[model samples]
Target chain A: MKKFIEKIIQGLFTVSGFVTSIAILLIVLFLFTEGMGLFKNKLVEDGYQLVVNKQNDVSSLSAEQIKDIFDGEITNWNEIGGRNQEIILFRLNDISNYFTDEELGSELEFVPEKISELIAQHPEMIGFIPQQYIDNAFKGKVLEAGKIGFSDIFLGKEWIPTATPVSFYGILPLVTGTLWVSLVAILLALPFGLAAAIYLAEMANHKMRNILKPLIELLSGIPSVVYGFFGLIVIVPLVQKLFHLPVGETGLTGSIVLAIMALPTIITVSEDAMRNCPRSMREASLALGGSKWQTIYKIVIPYSISGITSAVVLGIGRAVGETMAVLMVTGNSAVIATSILQPLRTIPATIAAELGEAPDGGVHYQALFLLGIILFVITQIINSSVEYVSAKNKI
Target chain B: MNITLKKRRSQHLAFGIVSLLTYSIVAILIIILAFIIIRGIGVINWEFLSTAPTDGMTGGGIFPAIVGTCYLILGSAAFAFPVGIMSGIYMNEYAPKGKLVRFIRMMTNNLSGIPSIVFGLFGMALFVNKLSFGDSILAGSLTLALLSLPLVIRTTEEALKAIPYSFREGSYALGATKLQTIRRVTLPMALPNITTGLILAVGRVSGETAPILFTCAAYFLPQLPSGVLDQCMALPYHLYVLATSGTNMELQRPIAYGTALVLIMIVLLVNITATVVRRYFANKVKMN
Candidate 1:
């Protein structure tokens, strides 16, 4: 009976472990299913295509160029590396401009055929209409609609996700903004965090260490939204006054908030590492006439460099993944950050701010998911590398 | 002798600077806590604690948000505790030390590192859209459960590791089976630590704004939630809306402070409870 019960318990354990592992798999699968589905979307709206005269040398057009042509920003074919001719834009609704309603008839039943004929007449003419309107047997050249490309998604500078004709899904600005805030945050946080960690681990008396330790843990436990509120009420105004800027909200404010938020992580991890340094090393350094500060700087730090490295890496991971505080304090300007004082939007902020309203399965929604994938991969890399360093150093 | 004097002066300076840095961290924490508490204490009252909002959330109290957060905590704990404890038990007791265990550990770490907002996205996709649960409490709880699972597993495993093998040996030598030994010996020894982990998980689930932002947070619902399916106001999300997009920002500023204060108190309470549990267990062990 005991053996049977043990078997049942073993089976339960295996099943639970298997189920726990499956959860992570499901999250990644769901993210990719929605994110990669963006690529399968047609550049043009469904049931519509762009057609030009067959003689036109341009066999394909980028979404941006098409938008430009339609918006009348680029009126000449020569501007797009094509023949030296003025481009004529046509929409199905613009048929009356070319042919009178009386001439084309009120029903406009043949408007599709006439639009195709109109396209054939002018080499520079680009017409957008129902895909069924274009007769394949006719001479109109149908522009091969391209799927959303890697360059368009990753390298594109504009993030206008609701642009007419096509939404721009470029993530350059958001990605750079995220990096800038996190970079500044880490830079500001590291020295102070290290100093505090060293003091707590090596210099502080038992009473001081006991008091300060729980305070730091409590700081870490404070909800990020509270930190964000603090940033709004305190840091934002402080930056504005200190820098004499027109607005308080900037990447600098976000960075400062993130720095504060990341401090507890860095200090805790690095201090633990410092404490873990064998007592004999510290005794020997002191016996050699090294001051406490000198001993910590030389012996304790060197002995646990990997642990400190992991601490900083984990701190960076926290800063990068942080959304709410950064979202609240950063001006939410979706522009590439020119300076720390300027307003910027991080990827996490963008997703948090925009995903609520974006229609499901829309380009905007999918782009947010893609941003999530990027964030997931970036943080996963940072964390696993930390894990690897710590694991490697374990022996 | 002059160089040695200069080195001594520099050492004193370094010591002063490091102490100053540590004090500054403490100062920052105090300033934040003091500011919130001073501004927020006045706003906490019976009416504020019991009543729902009125006049565009600028009047009345944050009762619904408080209840919603409690519901969310209860829901997530209900879902995560059993699964996480079970998985932790497996990893500690039954699982062999091998590549598979390593992979599971790596994945658990990875899960913890994934941004809470990304979890929001996943929750929105899987629970809200795919699972057709809509923006409901059940969906939010499931997402939060996933969020805290890694934390639970790691803590559970740590607690289990702290139990000596000799205890298990003694139980087995008494003719107890593996299951009985674990049930009768290991789990009791580990319960205090497991409770600490649960308290910590509560702190996490309550404080998290990003994951619940999409999954269940309502913009402004004054009444208490009637069912799991109904959207409900939560403390973090309520604070977010009041600060960012609510109709009258300045008017709601004090209320937002109160909400922040409440959130901080709850999280701090959970943290303190966990610490107390840990200390109690440590003392118990010492006494033994």
Candidate 2:
């Protein structure tokens, strides 16, 4: 009976171990399932479609070309495989420009009628009006928006998830924005973090080490939302005042916040690795008439290079995955940022900001899930590489 | 002679610069903490701690948020601690050292590195939709449990590994079985360290905002959760909402600061307790 009871307890422990493994698997599976749903069919906006007068030869355009046309970058119809004529941009708001209040009626109730008439008269015009406004008697042609392809999702530059006619799920802006912020953050953190690690590992006395160690741990333990708040209140305004920007919350603010957050990880890991360098090496350097700084820079640091690399990688992982702070300070603009001073939105910030309002299983919803898949992939690569390098160093 | 003198000067400069950088970390921590505490202490009062929020979350107190965060921490602990501890024990004491053990360790490390937001997305997919739990406390707790599980497992494993092997061997020498020796000897010795792990997990679960945002966080719910299936307002999520997307951003700024202060205090308290417990245990081991 005692043996049987022991066996039962052992079995329970085994089962518990597998439970965690299964949970990780399920998370990866669910992300792909929902995210891949967006590519199954042609992308269409819920209540609006791009329409052109039938006399125009252009009947279809990719989401990218449509965006370019709307931005007035494509001014000629020939640019989008149509007849050589000047492309006319017509929108719902443009109705008032073309007709008077009396022509559109006192209440503008006949606005759709006038819109249909305007579309019927112009062959070079493309209008983005509501589907409800396109009555049965309307004579214009609706453009066939193609299915969202992998290139558009992976390589396209725009990140407008609420675009008319078709929501652009291109993640280039968000991906670059995330990378740009993380890059700047790591660059800012590395010098300070390495210097601090070197001091604490080799130079600090016992009292100094104890005081600094707990404070660094305390820094790491502070919740990320508090960091976000600090950035919003302190760093954001400081950047704005110094740079004289219209808004204080730019990618620079995000980089500063993330650098502060990533500091403790880099310092703690590198310090431990440096401390683990055998005492004999340090003594030998000093015996050979080497200064403490020279010994640290030339011997201890080179010996622990792999550990320091892992520390840097882990720091990058933290900056890349951070959500609340970046969301709070990066201004959440879904534009391709050209400078650190410009406002930009990150992928995690996009998911956090937009997922609450996106309807379940919709295009917007699936696209956000795809963003998660991308994030998971990036972090997994970084994490696995860290594990591999550290494991090799240990061996 | 000039080159040697220049090298000596450079080394001294490097030492000065590095020490200054190290000291600045402490200064930065103090500055951040002082800024929040000075701004936030005035907002904390009996009314603030005991009353639910009103006036679009710009007034009143954070009573409901406190309750909700407590519920989340308790719920996640209840789900995570037993499984994580058992897994650690199996890895340290029972499981054969082989490829399987290595695989489990790799998985745990990978899970730890996954972003918290990914966990949020997974929770929404599995708990809120697939299982039809909807947005509720249960969904949020399970999500947080997954997030903290890797930390708990690693800490427990380290604690178990630190226990002296002679204790287990002595119990076996007295005609005890493997199970009895581990249960009667090994676990007790590692209990304090395990408790430290639990404290760290609590610190993590209470402060996380992203994982709960989709699974359970309610925008304006100001009442105590009646059941695990009910929606609740968490402090981190509430602070995020007030600071970033509030109806009146300027008016809500004070409440945001107050919430941040409360969050920092809670996390720091847990961290300090963990450190003290760890020090006490280390000293006890040395004395023995």
Candidate 3:
């Protein structure tokens, strides 16, 4: 009877790990199932069209042509599009007059300035609006969903993804915005977090390490919304007034907020890995007359490459995945930017900002899920790469 | 190389500076704790504990939120502890350094890194939509359970690994079978650690918001959680509402701070008790 019970216990244990692995697989599968619908229509995968210049048969239009192709009244001689004569560029506005919701920053704002610029320089240039703006009046002519499928939102300059079934779910602004914030966050966090970790693991005395350790761990337990609150009250206005910018809610401020939040995790994990590094190795390095810093850099760090990198990568992951803080501080502007100070959107922030009111399984919903998938993939790449490098170093 | 007075002074400076970081951490903790206690304590009269919340946070105590907090934690413990502990047992004892075991190890680590909101999304999709467990405490607890499991597994695995092998061999030497030895000897030895892990797990689920936001959290609640399937008001969600804001910004902020204070206290108490028990046993071990 005892032997039988022993066998039963062993059997149960064998199966438990298998069950846990299956749970993770199910999560990945569910994400893909929810998001695979966006790729089905297949009109365009992820590219912009050249608008097929009829006169010159130019396969690709110049940058000016791309610009003129967006302005409404660029319709005359030498009007951009690579020195072409007498061009008639078609815009969605020329096709239909469906302009509403002035609060949404209507196409009219960009249309006027661009139209004058096109008219002044080259009369024959035309601009391209979204296929949604192209509507029924413009259908069966030159532009439609037939020419550009749903994914063109990522391809274009516009930032709107919440327009749903009617408008393009342009993720370009939000994606770039998120990338910019997280990128800056990683830059700020990586060095400080690493140095702190190094100090705790290789240098600090036991009592000091104990006190610092739990405090850092406790920081993660602090709710992220509080961090959001802090950013709004403190960081946002301070930066705003300090720089005298239009608003303090820019990507740089968001990065700082997130960096503070991420410091705990990066410090804790990296310190643990470094602390676990063999004492013998360090002693040997010192026996060879190496200084403390030299021992740490040459001996300890060399043995712990994977841990430090994993620490940095995980910090980057936190920056990428963080939502509420990013949403509250990044001004929610869905625009691509070159400067760290500019307001921007991130994929996670875009999804969080709009997911609550987003109509379920609508174009906006699908688009948000698509962004989630992108975020998921980027983290997976980071996670798997860390695991791979760690394993490689071990062998 | 010759030792210089400057080198010694600089080394002293480095030690002073590095250790100074500990002061800042402790200071931050004290400031945050004091802010919570002051705000949370003033309004936390006996009536506040006994009464229920009413319209616009004017005359509401956090009775339901506290009870709901308790019920939610109990449910999450129920949901997570059995499976997580079992998985740990399997990893430590049965699966021994094979490819499958290695894969399981990696998955456990990866599981912890997943963002809480993504877990919220998964719960929203799976529980609210697929299982039809819409906005219920059971739904919330199960999601919290999933979130807590990785920690439980890691903690329990370490706990189990700490047991010396001599106890196992002695039981087996008495002609006791493997199952008998583990149950009679190994399990009793690991019980304290198991409780330690459970305490930590409880602390984790109590404070979590994102997953519960998607699965359960109602904006306003005047009642208590009556059953497993019932919708409930949770402390974290209430705090989330109060802090980030809703219609009642002025009324809710103090209550939110009070709730946060209550949360931090509960977690601190649990951790301290566990540490004391651990120290007691360690002392006993040393005396022997």
Candidate number of the best lDDT: 2
Model 3 chain B: which ten-residue window has the lowest total lDDT? Answer: B1-10
Candidate 2 Cα outliers beyond 4 Å, as residue runs: A46-56, A68-79, A84-143, B1-8
Mind giving the per-residue lDDT tens digits that candidate 3 earns over A46-153?
Answer: 222223223333334333233344443454444533454656654444533333445224655544333333333433334444433322322122222342344465
DockQ of each model vs. true complex = 0.73, 0.76, 0.36
Give the winner by TM-score: 1
**Candidate 2: tens digits of C-alpha lDDT, residues A1-395:** 98898899999899877766898799889999999998874666767778899898887888778878888889999987888989898988888789998998887788888888888899999998887988887878888878888998998787888776567888989988999999999999898899999988998899988788888888888889999989999999999999999999999999999999999999999998999999999999989988788899999999999999999999999999999999999998988999999999999999999999999998899999999999999999999998889888888
Deviation in angstroms for A256 in model 1? 0.5
Better of 1 and 3 by TM-score: 1
Q: Is candidate 2 or candidate 3 better by DockQ?
A: 2
lDDT of 3 at A28: 76
Tens-digit lDDT string for candidate 1 (A1-395): 76786787788788777665687788889999999888887777656888889888888889889889988999999898889999998888888888877667678776776777788888989888887876666669888999998889899998888775667888999999999999999999998899999998888889988888889889889989999998999999999999999999999999999999999999999999988999999999989888777788889999988889998999999999999999999999998888999999999999999998888998778889999999989998999899989988886
Q: What TM-score, over all chains together, does every model reach?
A: 0.94, 0.92, 0.79
* Model 1 segments more than 4 A misplaced: A1-6, A45-47, A53-57, A83-85, A88-125, A129-141
lDDT of 3 at A112: 39
| CAPRI tier for the interface of model 2 | medium
**Model 1, DockQ value?**
0.73
Native contacts recovered, in order, as a fraction for each? 0.72, 0.73, 0.21
Give the CA lDDT, 0 to 100, for residue B17 in model 3. Answer: 60
